[model samples]
Target: MTNIDIEIPHPIAAALTILVALCAIVTVDHFTDFQASAGGRAPEEIVRDAEGEGLRLRQQQAVLQKREEILRYQLEMLREERRLRGPGISAAIEADIDRSEQMLLDLIRDQQEAEGKIMLTLKQIWDAQGRAISISRKAGKGVISLTWPVEPTLGISAGFNDVHYEELFGMPHKAIDIPVDQGSEVRAAADGVVEDVSDNGYGFNSITIRHNGFATLNGHVESFLVEEGDTVRQGQPIALSGGRPGTRGAGHITTGPHDHFELIVDGERVDPMLYLPPVPN
Candidate 1:
């Protein structure tokens, strides 16, 4: 219950206050520098890390898919055994089926996680490589016209927003699918700079080009003729279409050999038909 008060000289007190303030500022500056060093990776390093992630993602997808196929086969065998062996075998067969089902569920969860990682890696690559280029409509220079990406006009197998694609893929198809041989040459739709060339490992491979303010994507390509940063002209061959099942660059979702062409206007995927010439009858 005793209080003691000590009064120091005003000049000394002011110096102490200033010293404390300086220390606080120094602490904040040090913390900020630490954060920058931790978070600010060089763009080259980011792209390299993203590329490594992409490679691993592809390998993970292949392993998961093979496991899924094996599990599905085991389930089928179990069901057949239960059907042929009757009630006495029901208990054992049912147990096997349950185990297989749980495994499939786990595989699905893992596959989803792998998918997410690949997507994140792709975004990182895009960010590091300046793939998010946008050109305003005015900057794009009025309505832009594009040529068909594939020669010989094999005809569109899946039109943009096709109901079958939506039902099969569980999402609206934002691109046009043109049926062509697996190695058919894919041409650029318009004059642009190659922005990115990537594969999602689960079969989706694509080349993106930045055209003024608009961008075009040629997906399901087996190989690229042009590299990133290449300047291409309209109708120039840029890649080879590949969407054959069990083939390189052809993901599982594709029906067959085809080109998945997408046109992006101001960063939004729109129907490629809006820009391309009409399909031949």
Candidate 2:
């Protein structure tokens, strides 16, 4: 019979071979880990872990945001309390105070109005009494009559050509102008009681006398003959010759020496020719 040879590996070498296989497998895993973030795990599992971490971080941020909101609310409440405690109150509260103050002011105004009315009543009574006393005088009872107020030489010439005569009455020209010289002689046309002897400035004097409602005016005269309270006769020499001759009155010596004579009936001036006898030119 022929004998056959069989080879068997040693135990130590078999263990070394197994160790080498383990080392080779570890080297492959390290190489893969160096190149990629995950080592052979499912894509879903890796994504799920990432999402969980993000969720945790978001929750922490949410907690911080809640803390900030609470602090803001607390600060706002403290300010509100301080404002309400001092003069920093709301506008609505101030408006109510203003309304109460205005009500008191209105009461004061009402009391002042009542006092003013009472004083006005008393003043009216005093004025009426003084006016009544003045009405009882005898001086105002006299009548007024105009005089042929120029020198005898000017008698005809004084009342001559008085055409625009009616322009002497009513409204603003309530008084007619009897232009005479600053020093021309003036005579009474009729009997009259003198009321006022007034200086109408410009060296031209005026005589206002009364004959009932007939008011006679001798204006622009230089001097006066009859006093304020004198009674003049029909042909009496009442005023001296003239005025600032050739001025506004223009009662000069020659033709410019004219008398502006007016006769006022019922507080209104009328043409003097209506009363004077026709001149014997």
Candidate 3:
């Protein structure tokens, strides 16, 4: 324009513009191809991925459940403390309790959406701890057998030597051993599995009874009335006085017409005299 001259641009300029446009078009096409390849996943594979995510959620649910339990316990303990506290602590404790209650409300809302298992677990834990007892017995629930398991007295004096009791071990004899005539009735104190029937060792015709978690050992039996895996109930005769039929090394004591009885807890032997009835001297 300065020279007032009309000049045509080189064809190479137009060619270059077209070349740049083509390059851009080709780049866009390749980008679209990459997106298609990246997005191509089977429905089943996606479902599996989702299922894996669900499993992770389940693990999180378990953690949340435990947290909920801890929170609930704290709340209960605080409440109890507040109840026991006098007027001097009432105001401050009330405020703290309100705060805890609010926190628990939020937690409960979160847990509710995660299914009711958290609540159930918390309730079970509280109930178990609150009672300090185990159920699985007909007469309420207790880990220990409150009632005695065997016959009151078969009426033969095995003497004052009751060694089945770990408690009476300090003295020469702790139990009032009752001697049963050979083939006299021997029974299970409670419902349990037959741990073993042995003829030798401490118990001749020994039958180990696991009553819930408590244990009872009857040694020096005449014969085994029940086989292994046989379930026996309270007072169900599982053996007889005297000794086992065969000395197959069943872990029983090989001795006498009298059954040597031992009451055990966990694994340690406890004194049976605490529950046993009075025997005539």
Candidate 4:
């Protein structure tokens, strides 16, 4: 039996061993880098990063809370200002009052109109009983209701159908005449749109307002505060009353300074007193 000795190269063996060790070291470093990204960092580093992120989030929350507080303070201030101004003084409150008052006036007008119808029915019943119903022409003319157009200080110089005056008509005057001081304000009887503003060269400055189904005429006006096609609310000033005996716009048929007020229903002239608020005592 012959014994054979195998010779291995030292440099090749050493290089092979070094390569294996280098591969093991590279694999360990790669795993460590992966662990750091996956939240497996060193304990001290993890705590430091967590504290920083928490502080940042808390700061953001504080900022948001501060903004909320500022908004709340501003809202409170606005409320306080409104409270200090007193009731019915704010714009919204004033608007509400105006709306409510207008609605109430309108309701009253409707109720009065209904009452007029009821009175007419009562009159018919009386007539059926062989009793003559003496309906006051001035008080109940079966007409729609309206707000007063003039101030209380004024008085009716001539009534709707006074046969005493020739200028007022031979039998029945179509309108009423209320004496007013110079430059007295004349308001609308109800909500309406101005249909016409005309002047008769003889002396009648008239402003006609068209309502729901009726209309009102403000005649013998000195000057008009509203124009044709203008919308007016009930009791809204439409003209300055001026129809004196010698005024520029005084009606030729009018005896003195007065507002020749007329109410027309469905195109037919009616007595104004029946619709207007009662004459001030």
Q: lDDT scores for all predictions?
A: 0.65, 0.47, 0.50, 0.59
TM-score per prediction, in order, is 0.54, 0.37, 0.37, 0.46
List model 2 lDDT by residue over 51-103, tens digit each.
95675456434433333232233234334434554786667544533443343
Candidate 1 ranges with C-alpha deviation above 4 Å: 1-142, 200-202
Residue 269 displacement (Å), model 4: 1.1
On lDDT, the stronger of 1 and 4 is 1
**Per-candidate alpha-carbon RMSD to the true structure:** 12.6, 50.9, 26.4, 34.3
- Per residue, candidate 4 scores C-alpha lDDT tens digits across 48-119 of 768856754564444333332322332343344345557757576445335433433443456554334323
Q: Which structure among the candidates has the greatest lDDT?
A: 1
Model 4 residue 85 CA deviation (Å) reads 44
Local accuracy of candidate 1 as per-residue lDDT tens digits, 1-281: 89998766697888899999999999989867865875876657667767967865664455344544433443454455456557766564457446644644564457665355334433433342234334222236436788988953668878888986544434456678887756889998888888778865534677888786688777768888999989999989999888654345654445456888777776566887866767777
In model 1, pairs of residues that clash are: 135-213, 203-251
For model 1, what is the error of residue 88's alpha carbon versus the real structure, in angstroms, after optimal superposition?
A: 51
lDDT, residue 72, model 1: 44
Q: Ranking by lDDT, best first?
A: 1, 4, 3, 2
User: Which parts of model 4 have CA positions greater than 4 angstroms off?
Assistant: 1-143, 152-154, 167-172, 200-202
